[model samples]
Every structure is written in C-alpha cells, then in structure tokens.
Target: MRLRVEFTTEPFDLDEAPAHAVVAREVIQSADLDAVDVGPFGNTAEGHADAVLAAVDALLRDSLGAGATRISLQVNVVAEGHK
Candidate 1:
C-alpha cells in the first residue's frame, strides 16, 4: 500500500524556507520516497506505507530538533484507485 504525509512547521517564517522545513525535505528525500511536493503552507510526500511512516517520524524528530516550535502533520494511507 501507498501513503501520503503532509506537514507544516510553525514558529518559522511561512514565506521562506526555514531550517525545519529544510530538514524535513532532506529527511524525506534521504528516505528515498517516491515523491515530495513542497508548497507555501506545507509539504507532501507519497510512497510506500512503511517509507512514508518512517519519513514522517524522521520529519517530526528532525524538524523539532532543528528548532521547529510545532508541526501539523496529515497522513493518508489509502491505496491507489480507492474511493
């Protein structure tokens, strides 16, 4: 099954890339996920269920460790072509 994780870090400028955001991207990419999209408010990563979960966990840990005050995460693990 595939999963998607979206997250937003707070206490940092939403307009520019903060350290936490950078860490999130690096961690997600390092996990070798299928895809990761970064938007103005948050970022989204989609891939295998296990990878997504692990990446999300790493994202949270690293982001907070990188100085993120708070994080809003949304995780979806519905297989493709589902209603």
Candidate 2:
C-alpha cells in the first residue's frame, strides 16, 4: 500500500515556523521513502506502508523533542493507479 501525509506542528507561527517543523521536515525528507512534495503546511510521500509509518513515528518523536507542543497530521492511503 501507498500513503500521503500532511504534518503541522505548534506552537504554529505562520510567519516564522518553529525549529521542530524544520527538524521534522528533514526527518521525512531523509527517510528512504518516495517524496512527492513538501512545504510549510504539509508534505506528501508515497512508499511501503511500513516504511512510511516508521518515518512518521520518528518524525513525531524528533518534533516533540524539539519542543513541539502539538501536531496535526493527515494521512491517506492511496491505490496504485496509472499517472
């Protein structure tokens, strides 16, 4: 199975996002999973469900360690369809 995920962390300041966001972004990008897109509001990646879930877990831990009081995440399971 494949997945798409969006992540947001707070204390959220639209103008200047917290350091935890940056750390979380790096964690996701560094994962060996497929990278579709990434941005301040959210990110999108596709790969094995296990790998994606692992990456998400790691990201969460790192973000919290970096001082993220709260996080918002949206995950979607995508079917392999012709693009």
TM-score of each: 0.84, 0.84
Tens-digit lDDT track of model 2 for 9-70? 78877898689988888888888788557777776777778888998899899999999999
Q: What do the candidate models score in CA lDDT, each in turn?
A: 0.82, 0.81
Put down candidate 1 lDDT per residue, 3-77, tens digits, no spaces.
Answer: 888888877685778898788878977886777788768788888888888888888899999998999988888
- The Cα error of candidate 2 at residue 44, in Å, is 2.1
Instruction: Give candidate 1's error at residue 64 in angstroms.
Output: 0.5
Candidate number with greatest lDDT: 1
RMSD of each: 2.3, 1.8
Error of 1 at 29 (Å): 2.0
Q: Positional deviation of 4 in candidate 1, in angstroms?
A: 0.7
TM-score of 2: 0.84
Runs off by more than 4 Å, candidate 1: 81-83
